[model samples]
Target chain A: MSSTPTALPDPMTLREVYQQQQPYTRMTPLLVSESLSKLIHGDVLVKAESLQKTGAFKFRGAIYRLLLLTPEQKQQGVTAYSSGNFARGLAAAGKILNVKVTLVMPADAPENKIASAKKLGANVVLCQQMEPSREEAAQKLSEDIANQNGSILLHPFDDPEIIKGQSAVGVELMQQLQQQQINCQSLLCPVGGGSLVAGCSLLFDPFHTSTQVFGVEPEGYAGMNQSLLVNHLSRAPGKNLSHCDALLARSPGKANFEVVRQTSVKGLRVSEHFVVEAVQIAFEELKLVLEPSGAIALGALMQYPAQFRGQTVVAIATGGNVDKALFTELVNK
Target chain B: MSSTPTALPDPMTLREVYQQQQPYTRMTPLLVSESLSKLIHGDVLVKAESLQKTGAFKFRGAIYRLLLLTPEQKQQGVTAYSSGNFARGLAAAGKILNVKVTLVMPADAPENKIASAKKLGANVVLCQQMEPSREEAAQKLSEDIANQNGSILLHPFDDPEIIKGQSAVGVELMQQLQQQQINCQSLLCPVGGGSLVAGCSLLFDPFHTSTQVFGVEPEGYAGMNQSLLVNHLSRAPGKNLSHCDALLARSPGKANFEVVRQTSVKGLRVSEHFVVEAVQIAFEELKLVLEPSGAIALGALMQYPAQFRGQTVVAIATGGNVDKALFTELVNK
Candidate 1:
């Protein structure tokens, strides 16, 4: 169900959002991975958003969304639903901006994520219903809460303003690449509901540069890839279990899909094994902790090396919020 | 034994070395740890040298050492002995500079460290002797190799030039602190033969600023602390075992001790349990993978929070090159 194509934000708008968020956001290092480069026979630079505030890129969007709120809306507070990363990010942003945040998170969300959100002073409601899906159940509860309180309801990745805020990753990457004199041939982003890829693709599109943008997803949850192929909204099979808990969304958001469609963003799906291997590699070689969801894009590059051989590529590591037990099991295994 | 006080390098000299090494080294992020800050009722900033080339701050010293070599010396190559981090860093630096590096590492050194040194194209010779100590045995072997081959022998931490090279961390940190406008009252550095602490103390000393510097060591291997207390070079008891394999040196280097003494740096010791807990805390809160040696500074902060209460402090995370099994056990435990 596609509406009229939404216009991409102008370059000026992207810069304005980035400048506003600069003070709060960390300029995460763009680290060159010599080991990964040798494996692919090309340059592989990882933008470590895993080191970002709240341990994820989701903080950028969350903070920007709160900044866009009216003075009255700020006073009224906001509500949102997240599996983990977004919940913690929003809670942290709310703490920084002195706004109250209410989060509805799945009961099975990683314990650390839940604890961190509550630690940041967010009122968290545990959603136990997994009938349709955990995400949908939590989303419904958050909406109900917002309706009752008359506070703003923010989507994790579907809103245009959130997309604009996430585009700051691209803005920062471009500046870093320029400083390093790197001519990037491909840019890879881990996609769940596709906000990160959609926003990054818009900035690194044909109109702006010749960089081929890719949205990488786990094999079973490849809705973004499927939707891009058909040029329409689609659902993932969701038939297989995966360790990438943060990236199990069944479908891409309509707003995100529309943006990726217009920007000609490509998609790739990686196996669970490769995602775990990527996480381990990040630990051993790059000395960075990456959640499985965050390492997925790097896994895609490893899974399909021929496509990027002899070219400079950038992979956006989305988050680092996995539980200790899961991370230990994956890395040790 | 104590030697004449070593003159500290002038700021201009430190700047020159930093400028020369900046292109090859990563300007790792200076992350403000909100959790740590809240715990101590003060701000705590972590300089993540764990993200440095070769996954440790040793790479900064290694590269700088190689750069300072004369053409003839570079052609003849160099030899050194280390337990792990220094070996890996020197090997990687040799690969970059096209110099032949021969390393003598303890046979019991971490498997990943030995493998990485070999992978980086160094001629690695494992020393099985642990009579006096693993480090001493390896050092003797390295010296013999250098004598036979007519190659220059390098002291991993005792050399004045190498300490100067490691001072780049201080130069970079000072600039970052200024940018963030943080008036750091205390600086903590992990000590292995005291090179890092000595280098940093020279920069943050009373002659330059009022910052109090501390060298953090494992309780059993607190050689730097013992040496500083008696105002003479002394040896650690070496009676207790520790997981901080990279920081088991029984004594601070004479050159390093002299520098620290001249700078009036203090020392702190953390127990093995606290070191292990610090590793887990770094993983969970900072989203950084730190080897026990690298995490010792953070451990010092946690162990003696009262010492730094209500003060802006900086802790240097020195490395992240532990084997997967060890890291898993530590983080999971």
Candidate 2:
């Protein structure tokens, strides 16, 4: 391993990125609930990315990444692998920017997601997740497409550009908190591929030094937490076993984990049952539709209230791209 | 009844109400969807007032009405006879402004809504709706409270201030349409007491005559449509009821119905099945959690595509305050 650190992207530059990109992206409200504040024994502000375009914060990074592409890159088009929120975000961004997007999903990825991607004008390629040679199959598909069509892979979290783009979220949060005159003592966000958390860490690092950042993970896929402890990205807990497949990243990004380790942040693992309960609360009380992964922050708040009391906390409700059928199942149950 | 026409409130002065009340009231997104456009066979824009504070467009009127109250009036407190969204909105706005709110809900009203009002610091007064005498009971309660506490009666839809306040939605739609550069041919909204439709009509009448303003009503409670045709708010359809209890008004506001009748726009009477299906679609596709009334515009579009095709149309998603248990029941069914 190299002893020297890679040049970390400048937080100021990310702020600039936010300024430039805000017209295209939404400045989602950071609303504090007097009722919720009293419930948790703290002032709680919700950074409602639930209202973000494509119903998640992924659109922010996806828009920035697509916007920054060169004329040649734009012509060559972009590729991303996900059957989830990011894929939808990329597809929507691609459609708006008039760029072509090719998304690769496991064959069993929710039909709704596939339909949504297609609706947004993406060429969807589906491969079975259960096949013995699936991982190899996906890799070969990516390489063969890249070779033939000169496409660029828009990795969900690992790319430096994507991380820098995601950092815009933190920049917005800091500015919004200040504008609202809210003194946030802590920030909580669900950790999936660490793109959103990494961006937040970078943005929160330069200001509010005492503000602790926390990432929440569904129990079966605490890769980011494990990786931060070991000082490297590590494998996901099990082979495609987590119900929160969005959070089932095989490893955290090296740069992302490094930022998390350096940012005075901690990770909390929430049980799947708690995630479902949080989702129910959000749907029933908050009148917000949150996917299981999207509800992880709420799960942490619900499951562990003592750790967060008296602190002005902000929770990043990452996305609302649950399969509608899954929501019916959860809510109905 | 007064023989003279009810004077329309001035829109210019209404701008001040919007400025004062909009901070607490959400200017919920006016989203244009391609999928809904395809389904409706025209461009479809949704003014998602369902996402408003207190989960409905009712907040706009309630907050504005509260702002207009004199210091003496505020000190005396306010009261309303509502078993639905208005109760929650009034309670929430009152909590923010330190005004006392007394809500009279039917004992049979959804438990969740009653709980929400209580949780938001409202004085909850319940009356039984099971008997024919319940209306007289409500009137007596209102009179008793008014005499005892000097409380102002906050009628849900009939008040001039309330109607004018809700007109801000029309103003917002106009502004957003300009910003989005969309020339809508028609506006569709759900009609319960006719306040939302009246407000919208005020905008479309002299301001944007080219744009027709339509209202959707549940077949179970199409009193506004009936009132428009008969030239009087009536209760003939009161026997035909709705599980969408928020929309079960027996009569339209006389003043508001007068305006709704003058519009060139038509009404669409849709079934409960379409409303349920539309709510499902809103949750599933648009990532919006709308109450049954909120989903009716979409329902109308889904049921009567031929009437809306080839024109730019905007739908008012009236509210998003469905009870969780009821939501579960509806989604499950």
Candidate 3:
């Protein structure tokens, strides 16, 4: 899947992506919070990707995906579907590379995210879909837009190169751990299309055998968790009004599911109720601003600390694009 | 003043402090926010010390101060007085070093900061001083406590060791800018007792003449500005009620003013109204949680961008120990 006319796919370790990303990426800090440690009764190393370029880990994948495009593909530009973080990440990446990019976001997506993407110079189209989920509707519109405009189709989290690009986070995390001389017992990442978790799982795979990776999802939209349980791409009932707008995918991406299925992905489902508290904890204790979806992995740890007791765990705080009004309300409450 | 520091503080470059802090410090990212750049039509690099240990750059100084303590001093313990960030930093540092730390804080200081310091296992004394200023009263109490306990009295900011330690922020910034091949035109830091700005000025001295260091203060408490203008430690009229509790020092430290005076520190005074907006900017655009004092340096840039127009400016976001209630009010309104 990593094979390109110019580069081989499988041998293309995240190390190469890491090298390519050096020019654009901020080495997000791995921080240990005393308050968080006290809460969980163990050490919790927070990988603050909330401070990543475009304010999310999605940018790592977005930039890498754009970088790997064939010259012919770059000439035509790229189109993708994202609710928020990916949209902003791709828009920023496209602007950086001087590539024409189009994004399909749900009409109901956070206004701040939509506005930020437009400001970043992306052609943004809002898809009006609510039957299964806005994400599916956005996906359909993005596919049509790509076909009509003759642009290369970019899956927000499905394609192998994108997953490979996303895996750069895991690679960087591993290197940081090694440098600190600390061995992690488990790594928690919030999963949407399962790309981040699947990619992380690959890096901490059986060969590394040192740390277990767990994907976290909101209870209703636990697509990756459901899929893993069923050993197939399963659809989740995405009917709940979750503040985690970024993780509203009704089903895991096909390619993402394939990778997770092979990798034996373990996932824990978290309810929406704990999200605001998690966000609050980030702002108050961790001095980080995280969107609801971005705070889910921390939410997982906070809601179920006993499971990780006595083990050093790292929770990936993935994004920080919450709208001012909503963020005000969430944190205030 | 740089002598013996009990330990040769003049030779105690920030590089050495940086090395000492490797075990506890997070190399806070120097982020270029594209959104922030477009807002002011200038390049602004954010040194996110909001993510530093104890959620502030004060931790850098606190830890370094604690680390350099003589064995006798360590055995006797230490005492310092701070309204907020320094209290937390010193408390956390003391916890790590197994020293009994005592902190004297204003009775009216932010509840969150008080709670956090207590949580870090410090002996907290709330000073009942609303006249002259909470700071002076706290200092008087701290002196009494030191005498009574026979512990080493630590100056929160005036001590050369603490100032030398805080200079590590400047050193890190220079390294980050060098790595990105960025030649910063001006570096901005929020000033209280002036330790941070004083330390920063030493490194970006006549040697690295390209970058000018500017210390920012809230309008009513621009003591460093007044002090620099007079070539001595001058007290400002501290009458305003502002949210920047962490930066409420009515006068810059005598030693700190001496260093900044020699270094020719440039100063900018920002109104309290603009500080809330800067806090909002950090929350929304930068994905960082910054206390009013921490965001004041960025506030200076935002309130007066014309001065930094068409040039690259690096603003130090010093801390993020803001109360949720205050944060909600600042961001919401």
Question: How do the residues A1-333 of candidate 1 rate in per-residue lDDT, one tens digit apiece?
Answer: 645876778767898999999999999999988877988899999999999999999999999999999899999999999989999999999999999999999999999899999999999999999868787888999999999988889999999998998999999998899898899989999998888988898789976798999999999999999988887898888888888888989899888988998888998999998998999899988888899999998898889989899989999999999899888888887
Q: Which ten residues in a row have the lowest lDDT in candidate 1 chain B?
A: B1-10
lDDT of every model, 2 decimals:
0.91, 0.77, 0.86
lDDT string, candidate 3, A69-88, tens digits: 88899999999989999999
i-RMS, each model, one decimal: 0.7, 2.6, 1.1
Residue A147 local lDDT, model 1:
97
Clash-forming residue pairs, model 1: none
- Candidate 2 regions off by >4 Å? A1-3, A15-27, A33-35, A70-77, A96-100, A119-121, A129-141, A144-150, A207-211, A239-242, A261-264, B67-77, B130-151, B171-183, B208-210, B258-266
Best by DockQ: 1
Candidate achieving higher lDDT, 2 or 3: 3
- Among these predictions, the greatest lDDT belongs to 1
**How would you order the candidates by lDDT, starting with the best?**
1, 3, 2
True contacts kept of 1: 0.90
For residues A46-76, what per-residue lDDT tens digits would candidate 2 score against the true structure?
6768667787788888999999989989998
**Chain A TM-score compared with the true chain A, each model in order:** 0.98, 0.92, 0.95
In candidate 2 chain B, what residue range of length 10 has the lowest lDDT sum? B130-139
How many angstroms is residue B87 displaced in model 1 relative to the true structure, after the best TM-score fit? 0.4
